[model samples]
Target: MRVFISGYYGFGNLGDEMLLDALRALLIEYGFRRDELVVLSASPKETEREHALSSFKRGNLLRLFAEIKRGDLLISGPGGLFQDSTGPWSPAFYASHAFLALLKGAKVLIYGQSLGPIKRRVNLLLVRFLLSKASLVVLRDESMSDMVPRNKLLFTPDPAFILSVGEVSGLRDGIGIVFRRWKWDLESLLRVLVKMGFPLTLISFQAEREREDGIRLSKMYGLPFLTPSNWAEALRVLSTFKLVIGMRLHSLIMSAMTFTPFIGISYDPKVRSLCELLKMPFLESPRETFAFSGYIRDIMIKWDRKSEGLKCEVEILREKVRSVFTRSLNLLLGREA
Candidate 1:
């Protein structure tokens, strides 16, 4: 059987690349051969070389359509690809592949995705219609459960939780902060970090777009800047931080996966959702005049308790994420789930 995987791949975004890695790993472990897997990517050559799989350029409609086969499986995401907040184009672009697969009689799986802040009714309608046709829809959370049929909706953890990391031991020091382009007050946040008196590092999750902001922040604040090339390197770096103040959702996910304590700075509902799911501390808006110092102080005081609790929660989530993949793949292949 042939499986065509699609997502925001080969774009130099660590989080999306990690999602592809975790999903591909799960598929292979579940009995699919490497040769049977194909990926649709922006950089086909890099995707093929890095993942060791066949690939097609995501923007080449002719090639993408030519490769679809009836009875083949199309796995459409594990990211927030259906949102219109960035623009209407993103939802339309990702949906086109799934729609094409459906038209070609291939089974479509909307795998572990987050639904919208889709402000436009037309975009919402289009997404609803696409979900209606999918053979299976597994969401990363229940926030958008209303959009999917109850019988077809199953909630699971983000696939990044399935990534492998080495065992961490001993006391960890320093603080890691991940930043993206958002409307948050950086100076105020930095004041709190300085008061906390830990060595701070600004980590870039998407270097292509975030490197400029990271460099400016590093220079202004006299902090170190790190741009990890891949997910494994990012995880390794995050594991060394005693505490991570993150703006990226996957940064917190990686921190939890490494059993490192984290505080989320929520610029989106998805970040808040992850914090709620894992029961962690988050600042809804650091831009507001909230008592930022006290918040960090409180977390530091309860550090041991939070770390132990997060480790337990991560283990439970790992099992749930694995089970979701196993059952979904079984059902798709017509075996008893």
Candidate 2:
């Protein structure tokens, strides 16, 4: 199969990179070779080097159209690609490619998509049209079900939940802290964690502004800083943590994949949603973070007591997510099994 996959690829975001990795693994299991996957990426060269897959500049219309003409299927998403809250132009920009690929006669599958927070009529209209025409639509959470037709949409956990971790070095004796731009006061919380004798490693999942923020915070607090050069490195780093406290979605997801307990700091609904799905404690408001150390202490005691059970729970979630992806792909391929 000649499959053209599109998303926020080529950006140095660990979450989206893991999404692509999971999709590649699933496609390979279905007998699609690496060479058959063509990725539309912002940095095509970097993507080709990293994934060993053919890539084209994401917004290059001629190249995209050429790929669309040759592709048998267009796999879009497993990310928050259709949301406009990130920007006004995002919905139109991301949807245009899928619409064009459909126009070129390739079957389109929207996988693990999180729809809305879309408020504009024109953007909603475009999104509705695209979703209506997609061959299969797999939404990442039940909250997204109201946005699309019940007949076409299937609910699954986030694509990252299906990621399989390889062997990595043993866990280190420290806390892994993942933070993004938020109004929360973290200095007090950091001081409390430090006083408790846990060494800190600040993790940045996005190489853009989040990395810069992590560095600044690390320097200001005298903590060590780590921003993984790629997705694999990120997963490896996550595996070594004793525990993780994160505001970024993928950081928490990686923690779950690595079987490490995490305390989520919600800056977005998606973060809160995932925390709820996992039945974990989260701080919804920034001020509540002042008492975070107490929350961590209580949670860690419970976490240590339930480590084996937690591991099993995460594995069950992984299997469920994998099954959903398998079913979605089969439907797209018109396979009964």
Candidate 3:
């Protein structure tokens, strides 16, 4: 089967990239050959080079339609692709793509997606319509299940949760921070880690302002810094730490994948939800910034001893998440022949 994928891919966001990687891995695991897949990416060259998959630049309607016409299935999402809070156009863009695929007679699988805080009436209607047309809808959490037809929705953990990194036998004794420019006192948090005598490393998952913040923090604190060139590099950096303090959802997800102990600083509900799902401590940004430093200090003291327990918890979820692809494919493709 020819599969065309659509999402927030190829822009150097580690979380989305990892999701795409997981989706490709799922396709391969289910016996799809390399040439049978096509991706709609913002950076086609990077997607092609890094993923070894055929990619067409996003927003080219002609290309999108042509791909839809040629493909047997069009899979969109595994991200917050249906939300309007980001912008009015964000929901419209993703929903329209799924709509187009349906119009072209391609089976649509909305995979590993987090849908809505969609308060806007028009966007909700659009999402409802688009999802109604989908052959399968796999959600990352249970909250969105009511929004879709009961038969169409399946609740699964984030696809990235299925991503695996083996345990590091001698994990370095230090704290790793995934930094982003959020409305929180990051410097104070860094100072607290330093005062606690944990050597610091700042990791950036995006090429945007977050990378700039990571570099700035590294320089100011005289510590190591990394803006991972790819997901493998990101996973490698994450595996080295005894504890990971992360603001990005995927950073925390990677922590879980590597079985690294973590504390999430939630700037978004997605982070908070994942933290809650993993039973990890998280502080809301700005609201909890003042107490975050002390919280980190306390967690860091016992983090090493606590990691195995955390790993066990995450592994349980990992198995369930890995099953999403198989279940989805069996449902979506099994009906074909």
Candidate 4:
């Protein structure tokens, strides 16, 4: 079976990359060979290098049409494909891709997709029309159910919940703080974390670090300066953290897979939604982040899943994921298993 996935595949975001990784694993289990899975990769070079298993194709209008027509099963999103409450380009663009794929007669499955505050009427109608014909719809949150009505819109948490952090060498036992989105106030937050005896590693993005803050943070805490451009290396650093206080969506999601404790600093509903699905505690308003040390300390005591036997919460999540994957795969294949 050819399983075509439309996501932020070419985008350098670590969360999107991790979600694709999880999707590939699930695809392997769902009967697609490694060669049969093709990604509409935005960064073809990064996708090719990091995702060595899957086939990569440039995600253009032509390539998009071609992939949809070619694949037997086209799963549009297990990433933040349809969310645009935060951005302008993504929601309509990705949803249109999914719509076109469905129009082309592909077994379009909205897997682990998060619905959003769509502003465009055209986009909304397009999505509604497309999703109405979906073989199966697996949404990530309860909030999405009100917006997108599907006969099979079964709820499953984000796929990242089931992800197991890979084996890596450089990961030391330290606290991971990913500051991709909160670049504006990251300095203050970093200072507070460092002041509280927490060693930090800033996950750099397109924005350059302020020279003053960099010097101050380095001098004060003597923390590690980790700048990973690729996703796998990012995960390596992510796995090293005993607990991750992450601002980026995927950073929190990735942390959850390691079974490490996560404190989410979210600017989007998708972030809160993802945390809710994983049953992870979130650090909501950044205005209150200086108080996070206490919150972390208290939670760590109760975040004792590994300290004891297998946690019941994790087991329940695992079963839910397996069921979603099974049901979605069966429905897409036109089989009632």
TM-score, one value per model: 0.96, 0.92, 0.91, 0.82
The local distance difference test score of model 4 is 0.67
- Per-residue lDDT tens digits for candidate 2, residues 150-258, read 8888888887776668884465567898876667776766777888888889888886877677777888889998988877788799888778898788888887777
Pick by lDDT: which candidate is best? 1
Local distance difference test scores for all models: 0.86, 0.80, 0.81, 0.67
Q: Of the candidates shown, which would achieve the greatest TM-score relative to the real structure?
A: 1
Q: Model 4 segments beyond 4 Å from truth?
A: 53-58, 120-122, 166-174, 182-184, 204-222, 229-232, 277-279, 300-312
List candidate 3 segments past 4 Å from native.
Answer: 166-169, 289-291, 335-337
Instruction: Looking at model 3, report the run of 10 residues with the lowest lDDT sum.
Output: 164-173
How do the residues 9-99 of candidate 1 rate in per-residue lDDT, one tens digit apiece?
9898899988998988999989999999989999989898878889988987777688888999999998998988877788889999998
lDDT measured at residue 12 in model 2 versus the true structure, 0 to 100? 80
lDDT of 3 by residue, 1-337 (tens): 6898899998888889888888898889889998999889999999999889999887876777876773488899878888876678888888777878888988999988888868789988888888887998888876556879988888888887766675554646688888876677888777777777878888888867576676677789999988888777888888888889998888998887777888998777778888888878897755565576666766677776667776787788778876767878888867433
Candidate 2 lDDT for residue 124: 88
Give me the displacement of residue 231 in model 1, in angstroms. 0.8
* Model 1 lDDT, residue 93, Cα: 91
Q: Where does candidate 2 stray beyond 4 Å?
A: 168-170, 183-197
Window of ten residues with lowest summed lDDT in model 1 = 287-296
Best-to-worst TM-score order: 1, 2, 3, 4
